[model samples]
Target chain A: MIKADYNVFDTTHDTQYIYRKLLDCMARPGKIQSIQSVTRKLNDFPDGLSTLLAIALTLVDREVSYHLISDQSNRVHNYLKWKTFSEQASIENTDYLFINQNLGEDKIYQLMSLVKKGTLEDPHQSATIILHVDELSIDQNKRQAFHLSGPGINGVTTCYVKGLPIAWIKQRQIINSEYPIGVDFILTTTAGEIMAIPRTTVIERKEE
Target chain B: MGYVAVTGGRTAIENANKLVHSYRLKDAERAIEVKEIESQMRLLVDRVMGEGGLYAPEYAALALKQTEGDVHEAAFLLRAYRSTLPRNHYSMITDPGEMRGIRRISSSFKDIPGGQVLGPTYDYTHRLLNFDLRNESGAVEQFLEDFALELDTEMDTPSFPKVMDLLREQGLVANRKIDEVEPFDITREKLAFPAPRSARLQLLSRGETGAMTALAYSSMRGYGAVHPTIGELRVGYSEVHIPYPFADEEEDSIYIGELKLTEVETVNSFTQNNQGDVEFMLGYGLTFGQNEVKAIAMAILERSLETQGQSPTQDEEFVLLHIDSVEAQGFVSHLKLPHYITFQSMLDRIRQAQKESKVETGSKG
Candidate 1:
């Protein structure tokens, strides 16, 4: 049995539970939910950032080559190390990537550099990313936005999230140049919420 | 300014060894002796080896003591240790028919060949605990001699066909054959779904005993409807045959694996088909010790699983997926690690979500 404290849980176990819950969420598609006791002790990293650790530990191990990118690679690396048991590698050679940056053209371009796109035979083996975004939303016109359409969404509805750089959308439009090969993203909140936007999702920037 | 130093590989290796030593030595006074564990707790030791997928009885016994009786952890320890040992040779698959006789039974036809040798069986014993076993000695040999004296000579009988084969011969059922791709060993590779049937059975065979029993019980209770009959259940020692590259197959010593006395049984063809006779041998369940029920359930579930209907037992994918004790325990218990980097990612996402919607962000939880 896992020990729990005063509404506080070990980030490790919490991440594992969250991993299963996230799997359920992803498979079900478009279900918005939050997990408890996950981010309570994740002090240095963002709240709910433990979700990334959950993903890493569940997915990455001795077998997978991974790269953890952040300016403060030292602190984050230690926690990542303890969480994932993953051996580190340079950004270029990574099979899985964890990026902590804003969602702008520069950041988007920065991430795109690491995309392997994979081979034609094994599409699932391609490089995947967990991009950390700060804010996302629509412009004043409400037309230039991330109006979504997919399995979970009932219809084409425009929903806005803030703190993301407008350039991120621009970069996706460029990546849209090719299909069947691109990156997948799981936009997770410091509060442990996540929205998965694979390379297949279309994104366009609003023109002033 | 907040970034910590990257520790060198040398120091990390030393620290890791220290951790392993500490874990191994946690129980100082009650350190479990390997020999006693092997002798007294034979079944548990056998189970550890059986599920661990290792054939070393002593090592499995040693691991059981180290784990303080956590069967899954003991299996894990044995497996982790086994992984380091290089594969020197491949074992020639032993034919179960060649097994030296100790005990054998057939439910389909009770009065068949060998007259149901009930050798070394605990079936007829009452539930009362016997304290006299501690003092008993040479009782087995005496019993064996007395049973032989009654028989003038073993009666010669032809090897009978399997119970399922009878159903298949009449064509009263459709032959349900599943053609799936090769599977990666779960221990050697990461788990992904929808996994192939081979992978699922590998996971389920070594699954936690209680959890698996519950699921099996549920299937019988109509959560999943599977009517299974005992085809054959046998307990005895079969030679472990390992084949060397240069040696002939008859040289059994070339194989380096243990053939512990085991009890393996499988469910027979219980398919109720008025239209046709469907015949299938569900599982060839193999285990280390006298684990009759587990092996039988495993076989029944395997047969039931291949059929793609809505029986609780019929949902092979679901039962196979969730019933793995080792993987489930490992991943669930693994939540004790740290994840500050992921938290940072979460912080970034929520701030963006809040800003886009113009909602005041709550303090990072």
Candidate 2:
């Protein structure tokens, strides 16, 4: 069904815009950027699917494989495969993993633990996880704040994200503890905002 | 003096572009059609296509005309255009053995099976320029009409068996095991050193004609030990097919179209295998269109890179990195861009050195 609706999305200019945004966010970790203009064109699709799909369409292709962890039906998985022509692979073998917000904390931990961190010689061969969260903001009022400090951050910066369990961050820390061999994360929200936490970025949660 | 960036050159740049357009059409002659370039300048189009790594003849012709016959620029345009396109389907592995050969030849054996078909080549012809071609519009039609009468249209086109198969049957040529692993795509991934054979072949196939030829020549001229015999050189059309998306069977595929390609397989000197059996090594080259020289050069360079030698051709990094038309041309052309700051810094260093030398001379006085 999404394949039939693909004509609404401009593969050229739209993907180019999304790619630039993705690149910007990836370079500056935890910096929230929005692709609301492009995703607005796909309003007919379900919430959060459009934003995730936009990112997937920009990055995934036949050369790469992706794994989707969603409590929702297999529709999103089938749509991604058909649209991008990227194969669906197991967690360890997949180059990308798309985790939906509906997944439980234990499921997220298991998925994160299994994702490939890649070997020292080929750190870039690691998986990139695209997770859908409820919301992301720089204003740290009420929401849990994450202290982001690394290659992209100047000294230290704070990113407040809602609905991302502490378990996921803990698991990510364990997996990425070994330098240069860790998975990158691209967090997207239903409102079409996106942020990146590359392997080089160190994320620390500020307890209340 | 501090370097300052030059500004307000927008109008000048625009005028310069207009001047270039005017220069292309100052003669006021009838515009040469894209189709004419595609058909008449067939070899040129083929060269651009091979280097550009895109097979569209019409696009290649348009690129040639747009760049005013600059081969490197034309190929660069095509490669840039290629980047914007999305990869939809991966074609099934094409076999050159099934090619409908228009021209096939072998220099390895004196009289091998599927004897050499010398189809449309000037290898034996004199190099003298044809004065008659200057105003031969009438002669072209007349020649075509006369040439058509000699052909037997009823005969089904002949397909030839590979020359390497004969050597392979006798175990004179080393038998390579079928590698089922998916080939590395250079476009998708950054090429790392000690590259896989797939990446090497991809880079070589799309390499610039003159650059590859020079390196291959260097190898043949005793810089390296890869003076290989042309085991088989075939120029022909090869069909491309993609697996049917809805098909349940593996064999079901849709025939997309055919591409004109020149394939070369070279036979090098023999060496002992792991089993201690002596066998000749094979070098392969294939390109988009009928570019015989590039393909042959590719074959030579392919073999040369595999061999351990001190020659430039034998060094994989040197040959592979230099052969890319876009990369080489872009880097060389970039020197023309504004480098005021860098140049100024260098000037400051030189002036400082000169001042120090003068002080030393005064002290001596």
Candidate 3:
């Protein structure tokens, strides 16, 4: 029987591996690798995003509320609700919002506008976005010359991203200018490679 | 206006699982049976069962077999398995007075009422390996013939009194009551201090033998001071305690009767006077399986840990806290998981540090 196990006391070997990977992912802002045991099914997610599921499964606990812009079918929403026991929320009242290929500027802007601004009492209460981008590479979009000069970036780097929106980059830059108040991102390709593009990193897209 | 489509975390995870599976099983050519560990490597099985906090020796043997003799893995297996089974009934509290012992001896007196029945023991047996046992065609007889008797039949020896009990009756040793006071169960609840000797013994009994031994050794060397004597060492099946449904769990939780396990209980003697004439009973340690040395050492360490005025071993919290195999194993194996995120932050810090250092060097140079 496929049971939705939520408790830490009932941890499995693979679950522990997933848990550790999640910790590693969080500890470093924008670097991505595969977490253990999650599998992708076609059309289940709009962006075909499975890593979102992995992250949601790992961290979207009962205490948190999640909203989806791309998954209107509520397959992702219901699945997360059942599997991780996370509460469904509107864009207006959400701790986190998961967006993918289907979401446009209006939806993202609306969601971001509703996010609670960081307060002195709880800065972590602000909304975080787990944006799935298409194609992450160190040498992608040479004109943009995306230099990854953050904590995990070994040195200055340029990467090409095919599916990521230009406005989103501008939005990200605007948000990140506030430091400690910007939303973080995880960009994944169709091939399943990940490069964490956190709020802290600077990206200059080419061919404007 | 831009719409970026990105997300496929599931595929990465599936491959990681495959790698883990290959790392564990596919590489090994031959798989070993659990029975071999239970039968041949009995001592390891015993230690695993003792430390695992599970009384079932057979299951412990099976885990040891599966883990290829890794004690921590075996312990983790036991822990994982332990939480799965629902606690059916709380066993009655068995008294040491009602223990049916096969091997009982006292260091103070060579000849007691039971007359020292050293059942199956390695004590006095030469440590050298015997080559003749390699080609045994038939069933071999017991090394000591007289001790072996029919199962379920009582030995003709008189009912013997506990060495500590005798000492207490004489008014020559410190008196502590094992009466109505309930000893805390570590498994059911979180441990609180200052723990009673009974609570300490409960912890010591379930503790890993090696870790306990190291703590005891440390205490004996410099950590704690308690010149211990083996007042009595008994190995036999004792009655287990199961709480009756009708009885009070607070005041009288355990109802007594003969039980399921085979354990060795050791009683330690602590000297109270300089002349060493007047003495005190330190504590009792009982663990599942036949680990007499471990049992004896555990009792000694239990006493030394309680009173840490002058000895390093006296620090009970420090020693008892680190002696858990499960905790140590979990903390150590956790490192095998990824730390890319933390490393990224470290990279940033290193660049910052190097820049500052370079600036200082430039100023100096």
Please, what are the lDDT tens digits per residue for candidate 2 over residues B74-169? 999999999978787889999989998899999987787878898878899999999988987698679778878666562456679999999899
As a whole number from 0 to 100, the lDDT of residue A157 in candidate 1 is 42
lDDT for each residue of candidate 1 in B1-365, tens digit (9 for 90 to 100) = 36444455778789987887788777586666789899878778877877787778889888987776889899889878988653444456566555655566766556644557676666899999898887768877876888785554544322333344444456533444545555557666666776676777677667666666777777777776555666566665667765444333546455454475444445545565555544444454555666666666676677667767776667756777666666778888866544466668899999988796665343342
Best prediction by DockQ: 2
CAPRI-style quality class for the chain A–B interface of candidate 1: incorrect
Runs with alpha carbons beyond 4 Å of true place in candidate 3 = A1-208, B1-36, B133-160, B196-198, B241-279
After best superposition, candidate 3 residue B125: deviation in angstroms? 2.0
The residue-level lDDT of candidate 3 at B144 comes to: 28
TM-score of each predicted structure versus truth: 0.49, 0.87, 0.54
Number of backbone clashes in candidate 2: 0
Top of the candidates by TM-score: 2
What is candidate 1's lDDT per residue for A112-207, written digit by digit as tens? 765666655666666667666553333334333465555545565454555556665565556545666666666655656666666655543333
Query: What are the lDDT figures for the candidates, one per model?
Result: 0.63, 0.89, 0.65
Instruction: Indicate the DockQ of the complex predicted as candidate 2.
Output: 0.49
Tens digits of per-residue lDDT for model 2, A120-202: 99998899999899999998684889999999789999999998888878888888999899989999999999999998898
Better of 1 and 3 by TM-score: 3
lDDT of 3 by residue, B73-145 (tens): 8977997899765354556556655566667787766866667877777887999999988886543355324
